[model samples]
Structures are given as C-alpha cells and as structure tokens.
Target chain A: LAKTTQPISMDSYEGQEVNITCSHNNIATNDYITWYQQFPSQGPRFIIQGYKTKVTNEVASLFIPADRKSSTLSLPRVSLSDTAVYYCLVVTNNQGGKLIFGQGTELSVKP
Target chain B: DTAVSQTPKYLVTQMGNDKSIKCEQNLGHDTMYWYKQDSKKFLKIMFSYNNKELIINETVPNRFSPKSPDKAHLNLHINSLELGDSAVYFCASSQGTVVTTIYFGEGSWLTVV
Candidate 1:
C-alpha cells in the first residue's frame, strides 16, 4: 500500500481555480494516482486519475510529473458547491482494487 | 438505475447489539469493498472481496465480519458494536482487479448508541 500526504484544509473563493496536491513518495511501479471528492453525507466520487503526465475530465484535471512521486488535482473555476473533501489515493493493481484513503484535504469554496 | 446499491441507508443500534448492512452491485464488477468514514471524516478500507474470494482484510476488528455470498453481493456484519463504531459505511465496486474506476453506492450511516 502507498501512503499519501495532503494539506489538511484549503480556502478558495468562487470563480477561482483550486489546486490540491498530494505526495506519495514511496509509490510503486504499478501504482496509479486517483483522486476522489466527497461531499457531506455522501460517498466519495471519482474526480480524475493518472499514471504520468496529465489527464483531464469534465470535472477536474490531474497532473502527474515525471517523478510520479506526487500528483495535483486542479478544479477550474471553482464554486461554493465545489467545497468538499478531496482524497488522493495510490492504488496498486494487485491489491484487488483496495483504496487506502488518508486524511483528505478539506476544500472550502466560499462565496 | 443505481449501479451499486446498499440497503438500510441508516441504522441505529444499541451497544452490544449485532447488525448487518447489505450491498449489491449490478455493474457486473468482480470486486467489492467496504470503507468506513469516521466522524472526523477519515475514510479507511475495512475489507475487500473479488469474485467471492476475500482479497484484502485490513486490521479491522474481528467483530466486523464481511461476507460475500456471490459476486454481486457483499454484506458487512458487526457484532457487539461500540460507540466508536458510529460512522458512515460505504460500499464500492470496480470492474476487475486491475485498478480501474470504482463506483460507490450511497453510503449506509450507522449510529451505535
């Protein structure tokens, strides 16, 4: 299992872009970095995933550098509703899809 | 149509009681998992099953037992629940064991009084 480290909390205003970064120094070769967002009273939903370089989706974009030791989740033009806990996970294929979630970054998008 | 679903969205039980939360996924996924989110909102993986076989079992208490009767269903049973057991439990499934996208069901909130 790969452990991740992220900020405890962040504050942003509407219309601003928010970028949360996670560090997984001991990431394995077969590990992929995935991000999930969780709102109050709801389950976590996938945001974006990437192995190297960058991957973009309708909701967010993931940026992984050449080192692959860390990844960043970028939310463009944030809104108050974007306030949620964002988790960065490093999952291995041999783990049977088991996700180890750390203390996610609590993103607060203020009006 | 709710690809993944769990029964008893909310459960309230007294300490020392036993309860179970049932989950089923219609996405034809071969792997299922149980994750617990504590009050402070720290999420942790408790158990995982793939093709009706136990694959990952974290250091969760023995009182918390997960049963997979088939590929589509995975149920969690907690015996002698404690106050600390109060948290939201989530059921999730992925297509296979190759680190594909995982879908999550609307969580099951368990409150132990």
Candidate 2:
C-alpha cells in the first residue's frame, strides 16, 4: 500500500495563503517529505522538500513537526495559476530512494 | 534549454502494437526513472535505473520494458499494448543513487486504442 494520505481537494481565493497537509504515519527515518505540483498535460514539478522542522524555498514552504507523522505545504498569496494537483510523496534514502505517490490534492484557486 | 526531454509527445496506436518512447536527460544525473499516470490520475513508478543499470522494477507487466542506454537516457518500449496501457508516461532523473528532488520531462501521452 502507498504510504501517504492527503485531502482530495481544497479551495482558496487569490491573495490567500493555502496550506495542504499530508499524513505519513509510517515514514522511515531516511524518508523525506516532498511535494510536487502538476498541471494538466504536464509532469509533476518539485515544489518543496523537508526532513524536519521547516524548510522554505522561493516557491513554497514545507513544515514537518517533531513526530514526522505529517507535513504541510504552504503557498503564500496564491493566484489562479497556482491551482493544480499537488502530490505528496515520501522518498526513502536507501536503494535509490523509492518515491511513492498518492492521489494528490486538487487545489482550486478562485479569482 | 530543457533539462529532461522525451520524444513522441503523443501517440495513438491499436492494440497489440509495439511502440517506444525515448527519453534523454542532459543534467548529468546518474539515476533515471519511468513513471506512468493512468486515466484515473494515479501516478506510479514503473522502473528505475542507475548508471544504465536496472535498479527498481515495479510489478508492471513484462510488455512494459525500460531500456537505459547510458546515464543520460532511459527509453520505454511497450509490446502487445492493450487499451489499459493508455496513459501519460513521464521520464525523470536524479543526481545520485539516493533519490533527491528529481527532474521530469514534459511527458509522452500514449493512447492504445
């Protein structure tokens, strides 16, 4: 079975901060929580990845609590173009790090 | 300036046909992968190769074969295709044997009618 779970969909308006959470109860020690955004007719694009605490890149922020059971992807002041399917995956470090993808959360950014 | 690229962006073929999708990465990554996204929007890993050697093989059918000629390329060849084989095929690459935030190509849409 796949190792991650996320909401099916979310709605956000322009200029609003959007946060999508994913649960991975059995995440391994070497596993990294990574998020990817995919637009129609395109492949998944890497957004943000984190191992612990909080990691922020220019595009998004990743927050992982102490338990490592869940993580949240935060998009600041989202726009309509930010609307896309966001996938949460757990990537292990051993044996070339297997990445298992789940049914991503469809984020709808309203005007 | 594309990092990863795949050929035959779209393909339409009848069942039992043999087709192939070629992928190349210029990012000098040592690991590459093939991922399939079905109509239901479920994305799954099909195969993984490191330095032109097969490493990870999912439970995909034998008809779906992956060929990595070198560190820079991994090609997918499907034999005896079925209607269930239609989906978006994505080629991805990473820098090392341990998976990092990999890079993906635009994807090749293969339709088996």
Candidate 3:
C-alpha cells in the first residue's frame, strides 16, 4: 500500500477550475492513482483514475507525471454543488481493491 | 438501480449491545469491503472479501466480525459496541481483485449511546 498526501482544504469560485494535487513518493509499479468525491451524508463517488499522463472523464480529469510520484485532479467549471471532500488514493492492483484513504482535500466552491 | 446497498441507514444502540449491518451489491462484483469513517471523516479499511473469501483484514478489533455468504453479499457484526464505535460504516464492492473502481453504499450511521 502506498501512502498519499493531499491538501487539507481548498477554496474555489464557481466557474473556475480547481486542481488538487496528491503526492505518493513511494508509489509502487502496480500502483494507480484514483480520485473520489464525497458529499455530505452520501457515499464517496469515483471521479477519475490514471496510471500515467492524463485521463479524462465526464466529471473530472486526472494527471500523472512520468515519475508516478504525484498526481493531480482537475475539476473544470466548478459549481456550488462541487463543494465536497476529494480523496486521492494510490492502490496496488493485487491488493484486492483495499483502499486506504487519508484526510481528503476539502474543496469549497463559492458563489 | 442502487448498485450497492446497505440496511439500517441509522442505528442508535446502547453500549455493550450487538448489531449488524447488511450489505448487498447487484453489480456482479466479486470483491466487497467494509470501511469505517470517523467523525473527522477519515475513511479506514476494515475488511475485504473476494469470492466469498477473506482477503484483507485490517487491525480492527475482534468485536468486529465480517461474513460473506456469497460474492454479492457481505455483512458486518459488532459485539459489545463502545462509545468509540460511533461512526459511519460503509460497504463497498469492486469488479475483481484488480485495481478496478470500487463503488460504495450510502453508509450506516451507528451511534453508540
């Protein structure tokens, strides 16, 4: 299991782009970076995932450098509904999908 | 239509009581997991089961027991619950043992009074 580090909190205005970076210096060869969005009183939802370079989805985008030591989650055109805690997880494929979540980045989208 | 679901959305029980949270996934997933989120909203993995076999068990207490009758169902039973046990328990599942995306249920909020 690889440990991940991310910002504790971030503030963004509506219609702006928000990027949250996560650092996993000890990322293993089989590790993949995944981002999840959690809203109050709801379960965490999958946003995006990436192994290297950039991966884009309907909701968000994930960028990973060649070193695989760090990754960034980018949310475009934020809205108030985007205010939630985002978790970045570095997981090994053979771990049977066991995810260790850290103190996620609390993103507050203002009006 | 509700890929992953858990029973007893809210449970308020007295200390030392026993309770169980039932979960089922209709996604045809082979792996299921149990996670606990504290008040501070930090999620921790408690257990993982793949194909009805236990694959990962974190340092959770003996009071917390998990059972998976089949690949689609996993239940968590807690005995002699303490005040510190007050947290939200979430049941999740993934397609297989690989790093496929994991889906989570709404969560069972347990309050030990």
Highest-scoring model, DockQ? 3
lDDT of each: 0.91, 0.91, 0.94
| CAPRI level of candidate 2 | medium
Q: Estimate each model's TM-score.
A: 0.94, 0.96, 0.96
lDDT of 2 by residue, B73-113 (tens): 99999999999999999999998876658898999999989
What DockQ do you compute for every candidate structure?
Answer: 0.69, 0.70, 0.80
- Give the runs in model 1 whose Cα sits over 4 Å from its true position: none
What's the true lDDT of residue B109 in model 2? 95
Give the CA lDDT, 0 to 100, for residue B25 in model 3. Answer: 98
Per-residue CA lDDT of model 3 for B15-89, tens digit only, reads 999999999999999999999999999998899999999999999999999999999999999999999999999
Q: Worst lDDT window (10 residues) for model 3 chain A?
A: A91-100
Best-matching candidate per TM-score: 3
Docking class of 3: medium
Q: How well is candidate 3 docked (DockQ)?
A: 0.80
Candidates, ranked, lDDT: 3, 1, 2
